[model samples]
Target: MKKLAFLVLLIVTVLSGTLVGKAIASTGFDAYSMTTHKIENGNLTNKVTDLISFTSQNIENEKNNDSKLVSINNVSDNVIDSSLSTDEEILQELSRYKDLENTYLMQPGWTSITFDQYDLLPLNSPKPLPSQYRKEFWSHFDGNQKVTEQVDYLISSETGKVPLGVFVNGELTSLWNDGQKVKKDPYTPAYDLYLVSSIQTLVESNSPLELSFKQEILANQSVSLIELRTQFSTTDKQWINIQLDKPVWGQYEKFTFNSQTGLLLKYEHYYVLDDMSLVLSSVTDNFEYSVASEAPSDVTNLIATGGK
Candidate 1:
């Protein structure tokens, strides 16, 4: 239990913010134990030789130490140039993600995603992935593992309420009566494979960004994606000089798109440091944009007590 908590604290250092990939530790920090992480002014430093050499094998059993070779090549030979230079152009480029509903709010189709993580700790060997997850929005998470869940969404655009229910292992455990009120709509974390929300993050930040386009073969077919970067400036008093290649820990959201329609095809996010790396690979196996879902007619008499 201490190791698990330590592992969680270890990764939290890198995932300061963001909801996609949630595992791995940067190279330059020391962990005396799982309970404490050394941080100053929201930034952490690293020098992990001792922990790697001294951690116990008992703890290694719990850590997933898998490693996959990750790289990016130019392949921009045929990028569909969306020349977004000026702020107005950037905003125009970002405006594309205006109202993409959350994964659950998506039409009533099913999605399967496998989220796996790796890192260097007391014991380091690639471990098997945990159970693959199928996210149905309402049953999914709110950033830190708890949030509003659903029964089945049959919202009334006019009444501003939605159908809510609960299930446990493919069985309906309970459900909320239809038309339950939601004071302020619950916000969802970006857990999709396509990393579409990364675009939303940049769009909402309203910050000036720099990007480079590329095309790479993903699962056989060529994919087009753009790298939008938010770099720390060394010249600024707030940031110190550091090489980009040796990022303490870097997380990237590589959104593969259907170039012609500019819609997300797959979500691939990668994070890496000197000793650990993490990946969240996802794709909508199939999406039915025109389909709409209604409340399940066969719900049991038991009403869902709490949205756990």
Candidate 2:
């Protein structure tokens, strides 16, 4: 009988040790194990690195065929060599060419043009527009065994634009653009920010920003004008600096929104640093959201009882 009791105790002790170890491993930052193995020394890490490097090299090799207009190609290309023309006739001719110039500016596959030509057009000309709202979901392993999930939304309007909300794990957390509630996990704010910014930038761009085969299709399509992309160099109360390869390619606008419904999406000019690097360092806003129906039964029961 004593031997049997000792064996049972030994079994219980072993199980307890296992349980305790698991609990400790899962209690650290972001609910990930603190002592988990890193990819730096793993075989899979080397394979992933090689694959990424190969893909990047192939992308760089794809040459851009868009012609760049640097200066006046032909001074008399559009000129009518009529010395007898009156002032009215000259003005009429100029107006006709101005319309053609605007058409060329809006043509497909047109990447860059002279600044003088762009300035000759009216300032209030309508540019590309974005959809009402855009949502994106991303998941990745954070070095640890745990996988992180993020959901971001870009809410835009006719006059201003801003990041409306985010969801990390079914909970309401930070509200940035206006007082719109962004539901997310409280523990992973940085992760939320990264996902939100990435989606917002993509949805706000006038053209495809990411270098991919999709950009070719976008360039060919007339509706490509409405496509949105964004990058961050700096952040401020009323302004944001979005990086671009060329100024004429697109305009970087500050993220703005309506105070009431939190539905404004507009872009304004901002400056880039002199260093000219494309990377933008920013924090992540990580969180999650849950609908009332999705809440715990105990919480719902409490709410129902309190209403009585």
Q: Can you tell me which runs of candidate 2 are displaced by over 4 Å?
A: 1-208, 211-238, 241-274, 278-280, 283-294, 298-308
TM-scores for every candidate against the unseen true structure: 0.38, 0.17
Q: Tens-digit lDDT track for model 1 on 1-308?
A: 11112122232212222111221221111111111112223321323333323222312342343312222332344544455555445434434432243433333332222122222221111221112212222233334432233333222333334323343232332123332232323223232222333344545666444555555555556555655433322222122112223443433444455433344444333333434433222212222222233333322222234333
Candidate 2 yields a Cα-based lDDT of 0.22
Candidate with top TM-score is 1
What is candidate 2's TM-score against the reference?
0.17
lDDT agreement with native, every candidate: 0.31, 0.22
Cα lDDT of model 2 by residue, 72-128, tens digit: 111112222343233333334333433433332222211111010011101111121
Off by over 4 Å in 1: 1-78, 85-88, 99-132, 138-209, 213-224, 231-249, 259-262, 272-291, 295-308
Instruction: Evaluate model 1: give its TM-score.
Output: 0.38
